[model samples]
Target: MTQDWNNIPTSHQIPHTRFLVDYFIKLPTQVTAFFLTHWHYDHYRGLGPNFQQGLIYCSPITARLLERITLVDPQWIVAKHNNEPFLVEHVQVTFLDANHCPGSVMILFQTPEGSNYLHTGDMRYTPDLKEEWKILNNICLDAVYLDTTYCHRRYRFPCQEKTIQRIVDIIQNSIGRDSHSNEIHCTSRHTLYLIATYGIGKERIMDALIQKGYRIYASPDKWKVLQCLEYWDSCLLNDSFTTEPCASPIWLVGWNRVAENVPGRLLPNFEALEDMLYMANYYRNKVNSSQHGLLQRVVACIPTGWTWQGNNREYLQEKDHSRLSVYGIPYSEHSNYEELYHFIAWLRPKQVIPTVSFSSSKRQPKHPFDHLLAGTQVKRAFLQKWLNNNPKESCEDDDKQSTQQLHNQPKIARKGDILSYFKASPFNS
Candidate 1:
């Protein structure tokens, strides 16, 4: 089970390029409860008095992180950390780290009917669970809602750990290119204007930089989420001595208005970027072009996406989308094509469902049981062709039942189900 994306509020309802998508929205069901995999504005967006009667569930890291971001009172927050399962109003909700975000969780719902449902909320394939978290023990999973955004074959799929390391290397090289990486900004005000993306790849970038000796940037709101990381407290943070009152950017001047309406008025610590004015050429040329001036000026970035290929190219071609000098270095926090396919095959879920951002609709997979989204077209097509050659259902007989029917087909082949991204390994943080 990935996310209960159940609503697309009218455009002016809130802020963001896409409609808000929340898995844990309030609802009146017999299950009577919900859990948010992460504290993204989308997941937590539109939460209101509707939730007063019901309870919220999540890991401790998620609870505290959300509390720090908003002043909604910590007491109302219900927490069940990783490795611990939670029971909400008779519904057993277990927390499995999605690996997409630190506190992001996969929910297992065991209902009164004895049927079991699993929802993986925005999880990437880096799903390393505790030794005790054996899904085989479930015996049978009635249904599964997969992150089918990348279920197709066209995506560039690769090992997540390798991608993460590549991103770290890129940042280390970029920042350490200059000798005084630790040097504070002087002359003009600068805060590494790394644009703080909502969720997705933000945590990995922060973790990587901190490891490489870059101090964590902590505005009060950012400090809250960063504190949840294991080493955040012990980790070094940039020193600040500014007397200016700390204010939320969203509250004072909407981030969209920051560039146009107010620029230099922000405090010096907030503007702690470096060398862009003097070393602008080096940064631009890093990507083999002077394009992406805006992205280069941004210390870091996070772009939310369902399909890795769609979003990946979207960022890479941001120059075409906008005037911002933005270049996309492939980084994603969701599972790639190969991982999703392998996971589905491993779990062997009876029925696969797709999570969508819509309300007033019957709970159903966006696509049929055949998970054929654009991202995994290659894998799906190959599988279709292989199955066509060796029909599993019709060819089976009493003798074949004693053994395996799949003789000619490679249980797994590199070229067979591989996607475009799998060929080149775009760094997924």
Candidate 2:
């Protein structure tokens, strides 16, 4: 999770740009424009119905959510299309689908000074992003303000599809019946499925479940949020809990209502389990006894990237009580370690500024992902190749000046000091 250090000016502001991405709290007076990457609460912490800041730029779907959920003034929101280049304060800006959620985007800023920067609010590194980069003619990025939520080496998990499939299999196996079978087996025990999710995102899981002919029950608030998504119509969602338990066996709950991760162990919320049991019993009594079986089983699945701890198992299942079984599956929307490494290597940006970390001060010295940066020699080679291919007036003189400045600077023994070298080189311009 990215720490919200509202006091850190550099953490929110893009270098040489007046725009701010995903920084709403404690709004800075110098900000020329505000950009929202998605509708997630963390990204729009300080935004509310009374938000009167400068125009907020985002995708159309996100714009709708901001108006419907946050109740922000529609006049203040500017909906930009993906891959469309527009000018903000004479700086060319474009939005690329982030592949993280419904309307998430990676903002690209290209200045007239020939400098480029990418601010990835939060992204799941996929082939689609690589294809998007190719469409931009593969311009060399000067810096990338990255979403380092899962930058650590321990965060390698299966892709979203595989994880969702595993979750489906777990639910199917727990129900003790084939999902494709048409015949219904009458038993004394009833199974209740619970999925934990945030306000937005993770709708893919619900969609997958609905595709398999399962009815989902969601809170009114959650349903309203889902209605803003493009795939809302396809979901078989019921907002009222007055229906029979078996009618919509799958229920969507808050993230913490399912399970909480402690330092050394995972603890299931027994109160939630009791509430599920109570609901099951109440529904069973309200209807004919022969119409439905007793609700005897409760299965809770918590999908998150943080649950993976270098284990080969698809999910960690624990039965704290005979009636309840909680499974923590590795389903994350953020880029994992391998994804982050490959992305940075592919871009080979001159400087990498991590956007997510425990502390802003920890970003400078002994950064956890410092090793992911391209080495000085690798950057130099890439720069030489780029300059040779895209020859421009004064290119040679600029290269020579940068090299002379590097040579004139004091000797530094750090081997892979790309940031330090770039700071001293004229290429920084």
TM-score of each: 0.58, 0.79
**Residue lDDT tens for model 2, 105-211:** 98999988888888889988976667666744577777787887776545668889998998899776645433575323323446777888888888789878766
RMSD of candidates 1 onward, in order: 12.5, 8.2
Question: Which portions of model 1 show Cα errors greater than 4 Å?
Answer: 1-26, 29-31, 48-51, 127-132, 136-138, 177-196, 199-201, 236-325, 357-429
Candidate 1 residue-wise lDDT, 1-429, digit = tens: 122323322211111111122433433233244466677675676454333534566777777765665544565568887656555545555667677777777776665567666677677764454243575354466556566555444454445554456555544444432255543231121213333345323556555655554443344545545566554555534432111112100111122311221111111122322333223334434556322332323333322232143233433222322222222333566776556655654455555555522223233322322332222434544676697874333222322332232222223222223222211111111
Which candidate number would show the highest TM-score if scored against the true structure? 2
> Which pairs of residues have clashing backbones in candidate 2?
none
TM-score of 1: 0.58
Tell me how candidate 1 scores on lDDT: 0.44
* Cα lDDT, model 1, residue 180: 54
